[model samples]
Target chain A: MIELSPILVTLKLATITTLILLLIGTPLAWWLSNTSSKSKVVIESIVALPLVLPPTVLGFYLLLALSPDGFIGHLWFYISDTPLSFSFSGLVIGSVIYSMPFVVQPLQASFDMVGKPLQQAANTLGANSFDTFKNIVLPLSKRGFLVAITLGFAHTIGEFGVVLMIGGNIPEVTQVLSIIIYDHVEVLEYTQAHYYSIGLLVFSFIVLLVTYSFNRKLMVRL
Target chain B: MIEVNYKYKLNNFLLDVSFTMPENGITVLFGPSGSGKTSVLNLMSGLGNDKNKENNSKFILNDRVIDDSVNGLKLEPWFRNIAYVFQDHRLFPHMTTSQNILFGFNRCHSELKPEVLIEKFKIKELLGHYPEQLSGGQKQRVSMVRALLSQPDLLILDEPLASLDYTSRQELLPFIECIHKELDIPMIYVSHDIKEVLRLADYIIIMDKGKIVDQGDIADLCISQPLLTQQEGASFILDARVTKIIEEDKLVELDCGETILITAESMRLNDKIRVLIHARDVSLCLSPPQDSSILNCVPICIDEIQTDENGKLRVIAKIGEQTIVSLISHRSARQLNINKGKQMYAQFKATAMIK
Candidate 1:
């Protein structure tokens, strides 16, 4: 029988990573869409680096960065007195970094589509910056948020290289569905590997189908 | 008074303009396209700024200094309490017409009721509909009501009717007039169409190449400026009151410093109107014609005579205190012996453009 701990841990990591990325990516996407500053290109290139860079390259850096003697892990040691490597928190950090562009790019495109004319109209109507963003920008970017949440959650669940390098594969903690499938394939247990792999494939298909249908309904109403 | 002085450098030209408008009437920024008319509106509303130029501009509305470069005082657009109606009718697509109209009212802290403006603009039926569901004219009307309900200290309309069909424009003019008549707020309207300018403007500021060419009362400016009269060669406007209507002849008698007869229908007595007569249509006769098909023959004294560009003589004359222009060839002036202080009968077929 397949253990359920890896499935639960995978869902929890995907959920937590998506939530954290949403909070961090919103303002960053808004700034990218509206700013004319010179550093805009620099910020955009950095955000998109994960899409083109090799997964092993990113995993190597994350491994060094989260070790007990490294920069982030040294800071965490002073606060939590627990090492970051092989911990669930380490896996979450890895997933968030690997899945950032999935959340930010769609949001930036949607914000750009809204454009500046509507915002200026809102400002002349006595809505300040924050008020305009909430009432005008947020409501108009509903499709962007939906796409970002789906892509970010799915990307984290399928993470392999970054989670392997940093999570250290501890059962009931850092060992997730993808890592369990990898272990079964390595031991020549083809039947067990098929179980988790098929489940993920069907889950991803249903999620995308639901999202597209919901987006179509929204388009008709708008 | 609304005083404005702004200087900015565009990519191809420089805009240096300064003018003051009255505090109670429609002051039209009239000019051709690319003349910086929209830039003036944008600067006053604080919707845009020129970063390449020096920041020594001054904008004051009704004794409140909203922008002063020397004092470093620049208020944000929301704090300025100025409403703007754009040419495209930029309503929020996500909100219904009622919600869009109330977007400003809820934030402005003003006591003006949305129901009153909704009824006045005749947009009550559209309250439940989205912007895309409304027609172009309906969208513009909703935008106007949205701007009005804000209770702004000033309103800026940037060619609000430029994008509509002729019938829709005709339908929207009455609502604009009602706003001027009901609300006491000052407005700066921009338009390149001469008919819109003549019908709506009480004061006019003509611009050319980002500079103020001329400005004054609409009646005085329309007659004196060649730019305004270039299209038809020296047209003049007469502010007249209807004294009598002859229904059988389809004519109306107007007292424009003299009894002037015009071919018109559906006019009531004691109604005020404006008559626009082209100078080329007027012919001067030394004696009043005893039997002529032309009806209007008012006796006017020549005030001045100037040579026009195309070998024509423009005769500036007066019927009582009202000014009239007659464009005649130099040979006709010589034949009629028309000089300053000479008395003659000016005859034309006057068209009544009722305001």
Candidate 2:
């Protein structure tokens, strides 16, 4: 029988990583879309580095940054007395870095598509910037949010190299589906690997299918 | 009074404009495209960040200094209480018509009720419908109601009727007039269309290449500014009062200095109206013709005569204190022997448009 602990850990990591990305990526994406500052390009390039850079490159830096003696790890150790290098929380940080572009690019594009005319109209009608974004921009970017959430969750589930480097094969903790599949292949258990791989494939396809169909209905209404 | 002084540097143009408008009635910002007409409206409403902060711009509306770069005072648009009606009718697509109208009314402490504006603009039936479900005319009507219900100190209309067809524009003009008449809120309307300007403007500020070329009362500016009269080679406005209405002929007799008959069916007796007479429509005669088909033949004394371009003579005259301009070819001027101080009859078919 297939061990279900790895599958559960993967789902939990993906869920937690997506929640953090949405919380931070929203304001970052809004700033990227609306700001005319000179540093916009620098911020945009850093956010998009995950899409082009190899996962091992990001994982290597994250490993150093989350070590007990490193800046972030020292703070975490002082606060919780738990090492962050190989913990579940460390895997979350690595996954967020690896999936930054997946969440931000779509949100930024949607915010840009909302345009400035409607915002100006809202302002002249006595709505402030925050109010305009909440009422006008957020409602109009529903499809973009759907695409971003689906891509972020799917990208986190499919992570392999970053998870291997940062989350070292701790059963029921950080041994996600991809890492467990790698373990099965190393031990020459092709049947176990096939079970997890097929599961992921079906899950991703169903998620994307639902999102695209729902997005089409939204476009019709718009 | 609304006093504005702004200087902004665009990509390839520099806009420098300063003028004061009346505290009441419609003040029109008239110019061609790229003339910075919309820029003035944007700066006044604080809708766009096009103001050059370093260049010392000052915007004072009824003694409140809304923007003064020298003092580092620029209020945010929401705090300024200015309403804008854009050309595209920027209603919220996610909200229904009623929600869009109340988006402003609910946000501000407004005394004007939404029901009154809804009934006036005739958008009550469209309340439950989305913006996309309404026609272009209906959408514009809803936007106007939305702007009015905000209880803005001043309303800025940036060519609100520009996107509609001629028939829809004609249908919507009466509602715009009612905003000025019933609500009595000051409005700054921007348009390049001369017909729209003549129909609505109480004060006119003519702009060209981002500068104020001329500005005055519409009656005075129509005779002094050639741009206002270029469509008909020179026209004049007569502010008259309706003295009699002949229901059988669908005509109304107006008295300026003398009684003038115009084809108007809706005007009641004793109503004040303004008649725009194209200079080309008026003909000069040595005496009033007895059997002419023209309905108006008022005696006017020639005050001045100037040669216009293309061998045309613009004959400026007066009927009491009201000014009338007539454009005739040099040949006709010589044939009629018209000169300064000559007492002549100006005959034309007049059309009265209610102000």
Candidate 3:
């Protein structure tokens, strides 16, 4: 039988991960766009690492880091007195790393595309750095933000290998839609797997359809 | 007075210069391409100083310190209250003309009315349109209004007309002149165009090879530095007032030291203007000739004569209090017996270049 908890958990995880990515990713993306430091290439490569690295390899490191005695889990245990492994917070951390490039790359490209000339022009006209970025840069980078948000949310929803490695398969806690599909296929429950699979397919298509149609309007305005 | 001193080093080019400009009127920063004119303006405005923190630079305007590297006191660009009009007219693409002009004015607490500049720059009808919808000249005009509404203490124009076509440039010059005539704001105008320098400059600063070469008043420098008149090799400037207009002949009479007539249109009486006369155009004669086709001749006494390296002699003379120069060959100088204190008539065609 089909269950509702996996879909709800998947949506919740994707929403929280996307929100966290945007919070940290904006300044990181902006720095990568404008910085000329020699370390820029190194940081960029690290951010882009997830695109090529297998999810199992990334999950292995994350699992070790989130264990009761590991670096991240030790800190959380000191604060909350609870183990981080097999917890929703730990799933969030893993998803943030897995979805980072999807959010940051688009934002960086958009920031670079905004260029320096208009920013300099704004500076001459008595707009401070923050004021210029808020009024000029942010408004011009609308398409970038849209793409980053959509990709970040969708990629987190589709993640399977990393969740399986760290989530401990705890239903209504760490079990997400993709992990449930894997569990169903393993037990030969083809009907249940087909439902969630087709659901995600339609949902991703609708999200992209809304974004691209909105993008066309923005292009005409420009 | 405004003082600027910078020991700037960029790549292989090093520019170490110190100079003071008058606190009022337009000071033209004239130089050839790649002579660091724009760099100097950027320093004065406190922009593009990111990589040059180690170098010493100081900019003081009217006794207020704007930038002092020694003290580590550098005012940011937004706090400087110095508006800049770039050659490309960098108006924000996302903004309408009204919003772009208001960007600066709203940020600062200034009493300058935007409507006055709007009407003066003729951008009232264009306020609703975005910059992309406007023509090149129209975009430049809107940008000028945008800068002026800020009510800057000093304005910097970096070849504001350089990007426009001939007709657009001609159309924009009068608006720039209108700004000079109406506003008392001191301006630093940068250009490689000499005609622009002659028309707008109250003081001139010339730069070459990342250093200031010569600096003076426009009329004085035109004679003292012959190379400034790059096209004709030598020229002179006359500040004259229109005394009469002969509409039938399509001529306007100008009273400098001597009254001269030139074919001009849309001139009004008592209108003050600058006239540029090429040294090669003026001919010397022992006396004024009535049978000659030239319609303008003025009596003058030669003050100085020098032979240039081009095997040509340049004669400097005075018309009332103003200076005029004539370029002639050694053969012609000897033939006419031209020398200092020699009284003679200077004859030239009526169609001298007048601005």
lDDT score at residue A111, model 3, on the 0-100 scale: 96
Q: lDDT per residue, candidate 2, B70-163, as tens digits?
A: 8988889988888999999999999999999999998999998788888888888899999999999999999999988899999999999999
lDDT of 3 by residue, A70-105 (tens): 999999999999999999999999999999999999
Model 3 per-residue lDDT at B42: 86
How high is the lDDT of residue A59 in model 1? 83
lDDT of 1 at B112: 92
Full ranking by TM-score: 2, 3, 1
Of the two candidates 2 and 3, the one with more favorable TM-score, higher being better, is 2
Error of 3 at A174 (Å): 1.4
| TM-score, cand. 3 | 0.93
Question: lDDT: which is higher, 2 or 3?
Answer: 2
Model 1 agreement with the true structure over B1-355: per-residue lDDT tens digits: 7899988776678888899999987999999999999988888888766575566689999999988888988888888889999999999999999999999898899889888889999999999999999999999999999999899999999999999999999999989888987888898999998878877888999999989999998889877777776554356788899999999988999999989898888878898877777778888999989999888899999999987777788898998899998899888988988889999999997564555
DockQ of each: 0.87, 0.89, 0.85
Listed per prediction, chain B TM-scores read 0.84, 0.92, 0.87
